[model samples]
Target: MRARTAAERVACPVCGTASVRVHSRYVRRLADSAFRGCPALIDLRVRRFRCAQQDCAQATFAEQVDGLTFRHGRRGAGMQAVLDRVAVMAAGRAGSHLGQVLAAKVSRSTLLRLIRRLKGPERVTPRVLGVDEFAPRKGHIGAETGFCTGQRNR
Candidate 1:
């Protein structure tokens, strides 16, 4: 679909002005469900605009489509969520495999990057986190493990 000036005039939250003018233009890569049991991509043309109000603090703001994130964000929110779940379970390898099958245009590293971005930072207290070796594997020798906290903070 062709992008128009009026269609792009989404209300600017900072100024509450609907009189936005196009400052620049770009293409956004988004994910969509393919008809043949695979995934597909939808390239959305995004526009960056200047808010029409004189007192507005924002010099220029990129247009935001509903149900989307960054203008050219590689994957849509729903597809990103699926990739995230797969990533957490299988880490990079599984996520990359899935992306390939779904035609999501994501690499192993890209999947990892998405996973990292989505997970963000987790707060952890106490000195250490441990894993039991015996209960999970009784016959295994010296399988116990512990991670020293604060390694990341430093």
Candidate 2:
């Protein structure tokens, strides 16, 4: 599908200044989620705007459509989310197979890379602690082990 952004003005990522001046235009090809068991592609025509701020580090910036596009992203946000979920659930070879079944058709290496890119779940300290004394080696008098446990503040 071919489409163009309808935004009249967009904010510069660096300076946050809304710019209406068009520097250039380019087509971004994005891989979208499967539609009716067929792969979907979006040829989006987006504009590059010249930053209005004089001191802004960015001279020009590309306008991104919210929820549809992101910086340096080749896949739509929705499609990327689906792939991320697959990567987390199956990983590597399994994920690649799952992607094909879902009509996404991504490589195993890509799935692994997606897994690496995912942020780990937040760590929570255990509410209860358990400790026990034990012997390291049976029939060895000097081989003994010990453990320590303590409460943690939230």
Candidate 3:
């Protein structure tokens, strides 16, 4: 079912100006959390407001339902949160399997990509690094490019 917001105005993100002038309206399709083992959809009536701030860089901004969804995001915040937890809990394949059971239903590659996009460990200076040495390729390892290795036949 489609739903409309009770709000009449929204603040601009860049300039913090309250705008009530409606530039346009559209139905934003969002994927909500599964219900009783069935998927759900949210057809939200989103309104675009024209920014009145003269210095504001953004001309138009769409209304966002806080804690419910984000701009251009396909899934609801709750489902996205669950996916994030799953991505952190296990590796790609494992996380994907867990998500399927949890009703998130994300793919392995997507899970892995999400995990990779998250912030990494904090910065720290390395004291020491261990390594296993191996022969360099091409036998030109120590030889200059001007001269060939060993001896050349006349």
Each model's lDDT comes to 0.64, 0.88, 0.78
Q: How do these models rank on TM-score, best leading?
A: 2, 3, 1
Ten-residue stretch with the least lDDT total in model 3: 130-139
By TM-score, the better pick of 1 and 2 is 2
- Where does candidate 1 stray beyond 4 Å? 1-8, 13-16, 69-72, 120-154
For every candidate, C-alpha RMSD to the true structure in Å = 9.0, 7.0, 8.0
- Top model by TM-score, which number? 2
Every model's TM-score: 0.60, 0.80, 0.73
RMSD of 2: 7.0
What are the per-residue Cα lDDT tens digits for candidate 3 across 44-107? 8889999989778999999888988787788888887778778899858899888777777789
The predicted structure with the larger lDDT, 2 or 3, is 2
Count: clashes, candidate 2:
0
Better of 2 and 3 by TM-score: 2
lDDT by residue (1-154, candidate 2, tens digit) is 9999998999999999999999999999999999998999999999999999999999999999999899999999999999999999999898899999889989999999998999999998877754432334333333233232232222
Local lDDT at 87 for model 3: 89
Q: What global local distance difference test value does model 2 have?
A: 0.88
Q: Which stretches of candidate 2 lie over 4 Å from their true place?
A: 123-154
Report the C-alpha lDDT of model 1 over 29-78, residue by residue, as the tens digit.
Answer: 66754547666666777778788888899767877766655445666666
